[model samples]
Target chain A: MSYDFMSVQQRYIEQIEAALEGAIGSEEETLYGVVQEAMRYSTLGGGKRLRGMLCLELCRLGCGEYERAVPFAAAIEMIHAYSLIHDDLPCMDNDELRRGKPSCHVRFGEANALLAGDALLTRAFEYALRECDYAAMGYERGVRGALTLAQCAGLDGMIGGQAIDLRFENTRQMTPEVLGTLHALKTGALIRAACLMGGIAGGMDEGQLELCEKYAAQIGLAFQIMDDILDVTATSEELGKPVGSDRSSGKTTYVVLYGVEESRKMAQECVQEAKKCLHDLHIEEPFLYDVAEMVISRTH
Target chain B: MSYDFMSVQQRYIEQIEAALEGAIGSEEETLYGVVQEAMRYSTLGGGKRLRGMLCLELCRLGCGEYERAVPFAAAIEMIHAYSLIHDDLPCMDNDELRRGKPSCHVRFGEANALLAGDALLTRAFEYALRECDYAAMGYERGVRGALTLAQCAGLDGMIGGQAIDLRFENTRQMTPEVLGTLHALKTGALIRAACLMGGIAGGMDEGQLELCEKYAAQIGLAFQIMDDILDVTATSEELGKPVGSDRSSGKTTYVVLYGVEESRKMAQECVQEAKKCLHDLHIEEPFLYDVAEMVISRTH
Candidate 1:
């Protein structure tokens, strides 16, 4: 069945944008407002909102109201945004541009950017826990969802992945296993979290949640491989940031390990695997397939 | 009424240290274990475990076992350690020494330090939530305590205070009120969280929690005033950090607004008020008073 993937994506994007705008407080005249301003600038600047979309969609597919997932959707996006801000810091990637604009540090100064990243991360938890606890969402599910969020964003997850990335930079020890570990933690972890938390929010059972994790793992890996390909193929303008940075920095991406053609085939295989996982569960949402397809075809 | 304050303090410190040591995992041989190393380096290398002591003492005083508060006590100290790591970053305070040893960024690189701080903060929530949900702690109290942890460490709290401090640095517009607000958010918020969360862990009702908050607020203020005074009166060796940093940076502080003599008197008054708060609550915890006294008299 042909699905209106573009329209659905657009709708989800709009919902996510509105939720994100509302999630962050308005800029105040107070001295501490600068961090808030920096937070808004980065979080609301621009992106695919892919993480938020996955969360909302997964929640809807799990027979839960998508609206119930909006807070978490906004949260994952905020987390993604904060990671980007920190990733672009002078001490990290040192990139001055992100999403076609000056990075947080470039615009707000380094200290404010650092604090903004810190604030955005802390605020994400607050927004998440707002819908949790003794609220409509049961305590067990809320705690589980929160644990997923914290773990994915914590030492054994995204931060750990960054550490690996930094350790192996410009080194010849970047093996397939190391690269896989890096991608899984740095990027895949959050993606899986978005999926798992969405399922948890929808009150899915352990089996269903396991299926969600499997599907997310496949797509997340595919997404990173495609990202590696796009870094080599897409223009700087198209990507909204500097392209070929991985190659310039001698970062061992999928495209570096396997050539462009081989990487494309690998990503396609992962997407196929992802779709099969969804199909095994008889998910009514054909849009999940479309999202997997987009991961392979996405240019930026 | 006399308490063996020294022995009790020593015992509590030992408990906190052991808890903190156990809370953080050992360094792994994997690529990402370096972040864990940095996390341990900063958290284990500590000064006074005052926050943890308050949490445990309050829990015990509220008719709950102090052991129940150990997880939270360790969590607060982790949060505190992370803040110190970030504060001593080159872009922030630029301090090379923390607790008379090299700061995280100095020992680890700036990027690693940043990631280590992020990891610690995220890990704090993970550890706190470990005892929540369907656990012995009722979901209501668990959620309340977690919310307290998030809020106090968040934008309107410690991070917000840091923003204000950065904004007003070397500026002449820092009034007594602004300084008060900064101190309340920066240092007082976490101290207050320690007290309130400790009370929450003990299942204290709203009224009892209010008393804990009042006592904490007074002590937190007194603590900062003493800190300001110590910055001038104590030697760097005694403080474990550079003295006269405020004056050198031209940063406005309690001592900046009110001279050393006045600040000392103000701190003493706050301690008196704090004691009254406990007395009115009919608390039997004489160690609480001792802890309050240490805040004003501490050299570091």
Candidate 2:
């Protein structure tokens, strides 16, 4: 079961980094500088870049080339980075640090940080709309992918999840169902979107898209549950954030609700189920398989 | 040349109020509830619905039907309301009160408020998309209208304006040029979007759409400058919130930078220019003419 996690991680990271560098451009306008800086500040600092990598990896696995999904991969990362920036605001998580550096608002004043997040979120779609090769795949697919990302990031999905999380904070107890709903939204929505965008970018058929959706859903949840476990088991140095910060914020976690052993078991099952969906896909990449495992094992 | 401002204001307000009542739906789902409440809080709280009225008035003046433009009028207001909700967040303007009521975040908590804003924004497009019949005109016109609204609300337009506003706050003494740039974004972008949306919604020709854009740009700046003036001259009772609040925040303003007399002159010029664009159109409605004047002259 053991795999070369380090090499796979490095390869995915390199691919995502290269894509991002190619996607962003230097334009000299007053407004462009503000937007470019905000986007760079939020995205350049490295976390796992897992969402971007997953998008690329899935595109490769589903099709043959990773380049086709570059816009979507970059877009997903922008969305994730913006969410992190907003989530760390003084009114929200209030953390001073992210990925071992000062959070966006701490580095760029609160107003710029807020604007940066908003700009990044909006720019993601603009990038998709303007840069995505609609001609190659036809306008309908491109428009659909852009619309999907918007819907997933907006009300019924990621934002809804954040709202629910905020509402549930400091409550005495939350049902497992409610916690699952929250995770599906706050974290799962974007992850699902990353995979779906990859599928759409790759021009996968409806059946393939469905398979990707199921696989993404499983890995997304498992990734989040692993985060819950790490909050308790890993140190701030290893996690690159204050350990048990979720608990301190009075937020519920899978580990807290289901216990560490059961949480781990559930995460394993999720990874397994996700893999099962890919069983018939004829995927050739060993790296994508390794990524699914890494999703469950990441400390941060 | 002074006219009956009070009656004109009342009539416009009444029109917008009735329109909004029909636009918002009462739904029980948590997501829908948030959207409905935010729309009501932001749109129905007794501030003059000048934006919506402008859309209606411009449609009439452009030789289009008010009935045909009503949905667009409401949609533009929804977009405006969403911007205001997000702008008032602790990370942005952090305003505690809006139109005499506790701001969306203050009353509903930050999470719900954020979701509400998001829902309203998404629903705006949904509203426009559904209204894409173009009545008996054509599908091309309907599609064009929807796309126009989307582009305006997206990064290149309203979102871009907000980005510039965020970047400029508390950092620099804004020049008149900078003030124009900011107002063009913060105010003119959406106003232009509203006019264009209404024109296209009513199947207006290219010439008409172009004329409406000019008209909207003029009144948009006029409206914003007047707002800046009232922020200094009007009291909380008149404005439905504390006046001079922008001054207290140390934000840049038209009046602060240009002085009251110059700002008024600029607004007057903008209105004149807007009217001149429509001189050859041969508009039928006198109300539309009154609105163009009233928009520049309003105190609160």
Output the number of the DockQ-best candidate: 1
Model 2 fnat value: 0.31
lDDT of 1 at B1: 39
Model 1 Cα lDDT, one tens digit per residue, A1-300:
467888989989999888888778888787799899999999984898888888889888876577777888888898899999999999999999998999999999999999999888888887787755335567777877877898898988899999999999888579999999999999999999999988888878788899899998999999999999999999999999999999999899998888999999999999989998898768876788989998888888
What's the count of clashing pairs in each model shown? Answer: 0, 0
Find the candidate with the highest lDDT and give its number. Answer: 1
Once superposed on the true structure, which residue ranges of model 2 sit more than 4 Å away at CA? A1-36, A56-68, A280-287, B1-40, B43-49, B52-75, B122-172, B199-210, B247-252, B257-259, B280-288
Ten consecutive residues with minimal summed lDDT in candidate 2 chain A? A19-28
lDDT of 2: 0.74
Task: Give TM-scores of chain A for all candidates.
Answer: 0.96, 0.92
Query: CAPRI verdict on model 2?
Result: acceptable
lDDT (tens digit, per residue) of candidate 2 on A82-149: 88887888877788888888888898777677666766665565566666666665655766676677
Off by over 4 Å in 1: A1-3, A133-135
RMSD of each: 1.6, 4.6
